[model samples]
Target: MAAIPKSTGMQGGAMAEEAADELTLLAERHLVQPWPMSGSIGAEARGRIEGGEGIYVTDAAGRRLIDGPAGMWCVNAGHRRRELAEVMAAQAMELSYNSPWYTTNAPAALLSGRLAGHAPDGLDHVFYTTGGSSAVETALRFMQFANNVKGRGEKKLIVSRQGAYHGSTYLSASLNGRPRDQDWMDGAGEQVVKLTCPNPFRRPEGVAAVAFCDYLVAEFKDVIETVGAERIGAFVAEPVMASGGVIVPPDGYLRRIRELCRQNDILFIADEVVTAFGRLGHVFASQEVFGLDPDMITFAKGVTSGYFPLGGVMIAGRLLEELRRSNHSEAMFAHGLTYSSHPVGCAVALKNLDLLEDGLLEHARSISGHFQSSLKALEELPLVGEVRGMGLMACVECVADRVSNNPLTLDLEVGKRIDNHCQELGLLVRPLINMCVMSPPLTISTSQIDDMAAILRRGIELTMDDLVREGLWRG
Candidate 1:
């Protein structure tokens, strides 16, 4: 590997401007950003975020904006946490890295015990990975491997849901159900089955919320029957579909689905990559918030509060026991990551857990209601179709009108317009086509929540006015 570049100490005014310009030029020339359009594939200069503190980040131009999506829904303890940084430095100095293939580290061993205490019952063992994608990939692969070892190799089909976002790796991305995600990408479609997104706001024309829940459950039943449960290995779902516009499922939907999976002997995998680690005011929301007893749970993002890349799969102890007693007990699972149980990442995570247990988790729980209600009020806006969320995560979806709740055309880019206006007004927004997702740091105060809501309100109003003036939308 090439030697790391030394910082040049560029600070203030012209120096900052010149540094920002050079960075942008370098990115445009050589950087390949995630989820770029084909038109600007390798030559895209997006925004430049220079520094972050607490619930805000400073742009390259020195403008501080509220971190709306909490750095992609991580940063539970917020940015620039001295303790987390200190822990990483101390651990690196003490023992930077250790191979998981043979040697085990202290931090990793300790974190596993702490996490198991917080995880649901039966989920007592963990398999560490590099991040959410790899975590999910590991879970699916484990399911396949376990079944193959048990003489059920045909049970390899994976079931997922619409509007779910798992990861970017080949197998994990294959499980993604978003419309635009697979437009230009090829996946293992034959190995996966998708169910309807249980979004109450977008339920069928005449179905009520209760009926919608039943419909979703019934559909899963039909899928199991039609596909034959013997061929299905696992059913993967997010507790709250994070990137799918924060789509919260209908009441009792997840529980019913869980029951079906249990009855059919299919492994239920809760992909809590975004919801875990205090985002929903819990270390694990499966049993705490959703009443789920999944066979495996995949998590990342907030594990190290985005300070380090770390993720893991919480597996049921009984499952491992079953494997141990099987005839193929001598066979290897044959999967591992170089950074698995990384000493520095685990050290950071241990400290991050300390912060959460001390007070951050309780703080998140206390303010979640206010955060949710504040954004829920945005439904009154003419451009906002609906504002739905749970805990501190929410989405403001813009539509053509209230009567139909139909999305605006792609050309409008309503969400992006709102985000631009919000940025100008000193707030950042995660624009998802026609929706603005807000998931600020868990440390956000009630006063800051008010300011964020006010800015978002004004941003929508401005966008609505722009649309009306442009004759693209009539309100």
Candidate 2:
């Protein structure tokens, strides 16, 4: 990796400041940012990231900050890799566009074969999409199509879990179980059933982790029994819930769920959008890390290291063969995106895969212990209730008190406070309600990890002081 560029006092001085001001004004006037509140819907001006390289990004103010969230948990191979850029440009020059509807491209075909080789046994087919949401939509649609052709059209109900973040598309978003996700938005709630989040930390009071796992499995079994397995089509879950604060389920929880899905004949979809592509030190984590043989696996994000929008579903060959052998074999699934199998995206992904295969995956694995333990030490702080995570991802959950382990109220915005402090000290954090998530680039060194943790420790200490001075927190 290259040495991260140091922060120089705002480049171009007055002119740069004026340009930034102009850009912010322009955005406020015309840009509609995502996940905005009604008050700030179209007028919100977010921090502008000017550029990035290695494990750091330069903000518009010319301050170099550690890319802590790794650009929304993508950018697995780090930023501004010349090789990735060159491959994308070369592929575009060779063959810019090819319609998947009527034609195929070399990059797409070759990449499919390569991805299939990385996927679990029997999952030999791929259906490309623009991103994670569309990939999940494609998987659900395929399940519905498969059941309809087999005369099981009534089996359309989807099962998901609390604290899971699948996607933003309608059907996919409906599967999201976070409380704030559906606060103002409408979804197909009637078609989806959600189970308890398999988080041991928040499990019912007095329940042990081992028993919590059993309770989770038992709850699913009861749902299957009551809803009737015949009415359910798919059970979708993230191996490690990402946006829902890096909720890693109890041991054997996923395998048990897979067994239940198998017994009930429900399609098991592993939404590996965040856990795949070297995030968990593997190309895919469903079977490799969690010991699951899911019927379908949806992946995005790190697929192209966020260099290009690319995501897909890995389908089991047996499922496709079963569809082929059915009487309605000629039926079309009738689903696909215009950018499906995009040559440019595939080319970028191929190069990204090369980087991961070379040594990035090993690097991630080698440093994950340091990455996790460094964050885990933050639990010593009074405001921290828990610091839980696995692999390169982790969450620093803040609470009102340690004994109660109760989350701080929304007004505190503790996570945001920590994030603001961390940013000022040269690190970026993904703030959830009262939690801060950190998943730095895979190339982050042990020393960088030390710097990140040190800055975060100081940030939390500062936040604690602020809260105490405001009379909001005793500690």
Candidate 3:
């Protein structure tokens, strides 16, 4: 493995200079950034990626790595599509900014209309935002406003699931069940109640499939009752768990949850930040995979394939009508940002969606079966306890004891070792609490898929060999 260096490492002269300037600017702004790379890796890393095309990112070091994680699970349309760039450039030249409330722009209106055709029925009204977190906040606030408009002013509590991640804004962050993210907040826990993640692999002993569903329903019902069903606002969940180890729920889980929410008169908010577009072999994972018809659906990332920052909440007809009736300029829901529905972002998103509809959506669905089958091969490795996920999103969970099914906690180090080895082998993956996750660009070809599988297999094999050498494995 090539040793990562310390300080500004040398590469191409021009690229190094550009990287140095970027590093200096970052230091000046005190943008040390969250999710920093490990020290040796961070300090010596090339500070800039000059260009990207298709499924590859070319860093200042002139090194190219296949973007296995789709640039943080956003670039589904792949990188550097000239058509999207052209649309953005043209939109910027024409109308760079316009408020959606008063003067509307072509891109925003047209894109919203296009989105309406693709989203689940009744979810035709669109409210745009700058990114995923804002979209979640929009949904949260919209729920409150809708409840008040409908004469149920007391509904304020929200139900979320453990191991689910929404975003970084206050309400969205609160909805996230990761302990580390919740460590600093108090009001979030007070307002947001979390239920156990419906992970069959981690459920307690004697937890039958039917019983598990009942327990989940019971938990939500108890919370709604405690909060007062009329006062409980909405239940938010990711259709396919993304940040929390890519947990794909057992069958009937989502259907049961949707039914429970319906029975209790609680609005269901589908946080599809990671699963929307083509990531889950669906335009919307809620409809395509779970048959869930949510009152509000939030999305970002793949909408523009990470080309530009854009996200929004699609409101159901019932909510939209209520909002429209309650409109008084002074008393209307006035939550909005200056950059809300920025024309350039919308233009890029519009073009990107066109490309997705033209091919990527069907492309993802066609190849997902093969991808899952190839990924399951990792289950043969001794250290691997499980292989599970849907569409292009997947995870390989490591374990200390396979028969007992004891999950290997982060401190076990196997996950990090395997991840690092894979990076050395020219693959990039992020290890969740106890598993390594993969979400490649939908534009990647079969050859690239095979390459990804080979790289990951090598990492799994190496990890198992390391475990045996350390006397941690008997096989």
Candidate 4:
């Protein structure tokens, strides 16, 4: 990977001039920003953030914008954490990197133990990775290892839901079900199965929540019968699907799916890359919020609060015991990342966790009511088809015809327009096609949330005005 360019954090004349030109030059020569590389090269890179403090970031031009999506849903502790920065520097100076293969580092071991203590009782072991993608890839590979060692080589298919964004790695991305995630990209199609997303808004229009959940469960049962349970290895899902526009599953859906996995002898992998680490007001949302006891739980993002690239999987004690008891003797799960168990990353994560547990978790919980209520009020907009979320993660979806769920001419670019307006109105928005998703820093205050919501309302109103002038929307 290219070295990360250090921010100058300048807002003045000469410094700003250098920063602006450097931003474009960096975009021109290097830095393929994810998802937007589809456009022309050096296409005016927007929002060159120079610095961040609390819930707001200062652009190169010194405009402070409310960080609406918490730096791609990672900066749970918010940005510019002095303590976390100090930890990174101190650990780097003491012990930079030790291979996870042969040598064990103190920071990594301590982080593993600390994380285990935070997780459920049986998830006692930890495997570190560079980010959420690698963490998921590690878990999926572990499942494959387990199935093969047990003499069930045919049980290799992974089941994932539509509209779920697992990761960007080849194997992890294969499990992604979001729109455009796999359009021109190749995935391990033969090894994966896709399922319908349990999104209430996208479910059959009038289907009740309970009935919708039952239907989802029945679909899984039917699929298993068709494929023969022995051929399926593990079922992976996000408790509340992030990046698929924060598509929260129906009530009773997650637990029911967990039950199905148990009955079918399939390992359930909970992908909590977003919900974990106080995003949902908890260290982990698996058993606490969803009542799920997954066979494996993969986490990243909030773990290091976006300070360092770090992620890991919590291994269930039962899975290890099962491997130990399997007949394939001396089998080895030979997989390790160069950055796995990285000392500096681990040390930063430990301090990040301290900040989270200190007061941010409870603060997230306290502010959730205001966060949800403020955004939910946007449902009154003519263009807003629905507004849904839990905790700090939420989405505002727009539609030309709410009944049909049609984007009309707006299609995907609707999100871009609202984003532009929001940026101008002193807030940054994570635009998902026609949907605006927000997962601000857990440290965000109620007043900041109100500010975010107000900017969002104005942004939507601006979009409405544009559509009316264009003669596209009746509003």
Candidate 5:
């Protein structure tokens, strides 16, 4: 790879000014932004990433920053992999678009077969979609369709958790329990029931960890009874609640949930959009990390390492058997996206998987302890309330007081403040209120992890300084 220029925009000197202004104008005038519900070309538009390689992204101005959030928790194999690029180009030239409805493409078949080997024991089937939200959408719809075909249309409710973000689609968005995700938007809320997130750090202050787990399990039981297990179709969860501040549940939590799902005949859907495909040092973290056999696993983001948008739901073979045995055999599930089985996406994902299986997964596993320990050291800083994560993913939660875990006001945008400082220090982090979510590419090294931690520490320290200066904090 050629040496990344320091400032590609200014390389054109005075002549580049016109093009940069044109881009800014177009973006400000036309391109719509997501999530923040803000104007297209405001400060909310982080920056234009011109190129990336090995966990570092160069902005249009050519300032490189460590991609701390791994491009929205994708990009497991890092950026600009020549193998992925070649495969994408080759596949696009060979077979670009096929109406996934009536015909299946070659790359799609090969990728599905390859993925089945990586999925949990019985999850051998794949239903493709454009991205995480749509993968979730497909999974939820499948659950509903399976129930309806089995003559149990009443069992269409999905149980999710507080702080969980399933997707942005109406059906999956309904399962989202995040506050910011719901405001100023509509969802199929009636079809989704939410339970408390299993974040021990944020659990009731007076409750012990063991007591908290018991309370959570009891709540799940009560909800099942209240809704009647027969009325519920499935229980959806993330192995480690990714966007919900990397909330890792206490041990034995998922196994208990698995037991409940099994006994109640409810499907267990693991949303691994951020955790799967080497993010957690595994192709599937549901069974590997949580020790639960999910009936269906919805994955995206890292599947193609963010090279091309793709995602899918992996179904257990048993579910297909049940659907086949159903008396309503003629009833089709009747759901799909235009890019459902996109060939180029599958080809790129295949190459990305090759990179992971060859060495990246093991590399991630080896460096994960160093990654966690390095981030955990941040807890010594007074501004950091907790540092929790597994594998290469983690979060540094900012609090007004470390002892009480009292959150800083949303108005402070503490995470954003830290992020601003971190960016100036040559790092990029995803800020969620007062929480900084960190999931670097699996390709990051121990030395790079140290660099990331150092930058984050300085950023947090700078944020604390700002707070103390503004009389917003004392610790």
Candidate 6:
């Protein structure tokens, strides 16, 4: 409830140095740099968030703005849910931490049971981790171990879609399809195979709906054939590509991929970090959106609404059997973190789920139709080359020429200007290359969504005018 500060960092803002001193010091010292991957910390490139509530974050300058990106598409239930905070505080007081190796807590048990009820069938067993990246790492490691235990030791290589973002950790980053993210790692390319991302908006001009699905299927088949089916461990992917510019796979895309994985005896790991916990209408996006039958589902972000860091992989019944059998031998999965399934985090996650199911999930689902319709309306805008996304997540691709759908020459500046204008108008959004994305918290009301869309439309209009003034667009 205190006065919030201006959001600095990636999104720029004007704030006095003295008020931001604490954030600067923290970033300079303990914050293990992320995103940029250079591990470079710019003093001016930081935002001191004093606190947050509902659909807005308050900065050190006591400014509150709508959170359009749901805090990087994680906080589905919004921020500062009092019940979750209370549950976490109580858990911290009673049992701050516990090792899952020998001691299991009520919070983890209850949370797992609740998750089982919501996630797709067969994805019932839970393996807790500290965050989404770890959840991804766990899925890969589990796949490898499970394969070996099942007498398929050669299944070691994992396949992921191009433009997919798994996480930024060692294995997770390796699994990420981003070229720049993998280029920094010496041997990331060796472990993971990248396939084409299914972009319905930019599908090959003449390809049929089924052809688009077959394109990805054929790509997977070719990769498996090249590597040998025995050499494949798992196929990791997002139910709906989130960080990779929000690419939504066409209708049959997921069904075909699921069939391919099943036919090949390869594990299918759904990285639902951003798509889980009611972000996509259902509890898990893979189940609700794609109707997927994955061997493992990695989750994080919205589990606790960003109130605390917690993530895990939900193991299918068959995979759990393999894990159980493997545990009998000396070759144990042997994967865990100190903060894995922390009591406080698990408690917070349980409470967060309660809040989400109480009405937030339906709230998000109810508005997705309206949100997509509004985004689709922008197709008439000459600068909007493509508008794509589903459920609560969506993006608008900005272009200089509508006919060719070519990216603007000054795409970066246009993107930055759009973001700046939105901030100036009390709305926030996430920018991915030439695309402007919105993933407002599931708790956002219809009226709030209207405000978000209006501000974003204004931002886009302003950016387009700026482009014209600079002689970028033909019109």
Alpha-carbon RMSD of each model: 2.2, 4.3, 4.5, 2.6, 3.8, 4.5
For residues 346-441, what per-residue lDDT tens digits would candidate 2 score against the true structure?
Answer: 999999999999999999999999999999999999888899998999999888554545544632478888999999999998888888889999
* Tens-place lDDT digits, model 1, residues 1-475: 2322245256667775666677777788889999999999989999988899999999876799999999999888899999999999999999999889889999999999999999999999999998999999999999999998899989999999888899999999999988689989998999999998888888878988768988888899999999999999999999999999899987788899999999999999999999999999999999999999999999999999999999999999999999999997688999999999999999999999999999999999999999999998999887788899998899988885445455445424787889999999999999887889999999999999999999999999999898899887787
**lDDT of the candidates, in the order given:** 0.91, 0.92, 0.81, 0.89, 0.88, 0.81
Q: 1-475 in candidate 4: lDDT tens per residue?
A: 3344477556778876776677667776765566665666445465578789989998866688999999989999988889999999999999998887889899998989899888877999999999999999999999999988988999989999999899999999999998777888998988998888889888876778669988889899999999999999999998999999888888888898899899999999999999999989999999899888888899999999999999999999989998888877689999989999999999999999899889889899999999999999999988898999999999999886444465544746678889999999999999888899999999998888999999999999999998889987787
Q: lDDT per residue, candidate 6, 1-475, as tens digits?
A: 2334454342334335543764566566556555553547443345556677889887666678899998878877878877877887898999998887789889989999999998898888888888888899888888777777767777788898888998877888887775366564654668788888788666668877667878778888898888888888888889888888889887878878888899988888888998888878888878777878888899999888888899999989976766666644666677788888788998998888888888888888888888888777888877788888888889888865545454444666667888888887877778776788888889888888788888888888988888788877665
TM-score: model 1 vs. ground truth: 0.97
Question: Can you give the lDDT of residue 163 in candidate 6?
Answer: 83
Worst 10 residues of 6 by lDDT: 1-10
Model 5 Cα shift for residue 401 (angstroms): 6.3
Residue pairs in clash, model 2: none
Instruction: Say which candidate scores most in TM-score.
Output: 1
- lDDT, candidate 2, equals 0.92
The TM-score, computed over Cα atoms with residue i paired to residue i, of candidate 4 is 0.95
Q: What is the TM-score of each candidate against the true structure?
A: 0.97, 0.96, 0.89, 0.95, 0.95, 0.90
Pick by lDDT: 1 or 6, better one: 1
Candidate 1 Cα errors over 4 Å, as ranges: 1-8, 401-412
lDDT score for residue 380 of model 2: 99
Clashes per model (N, Cα, C within 3 A): 0, 0, 1, 0, 0, 9
- Cα deviation of 256 in candidate 2 (Å)? 0.7
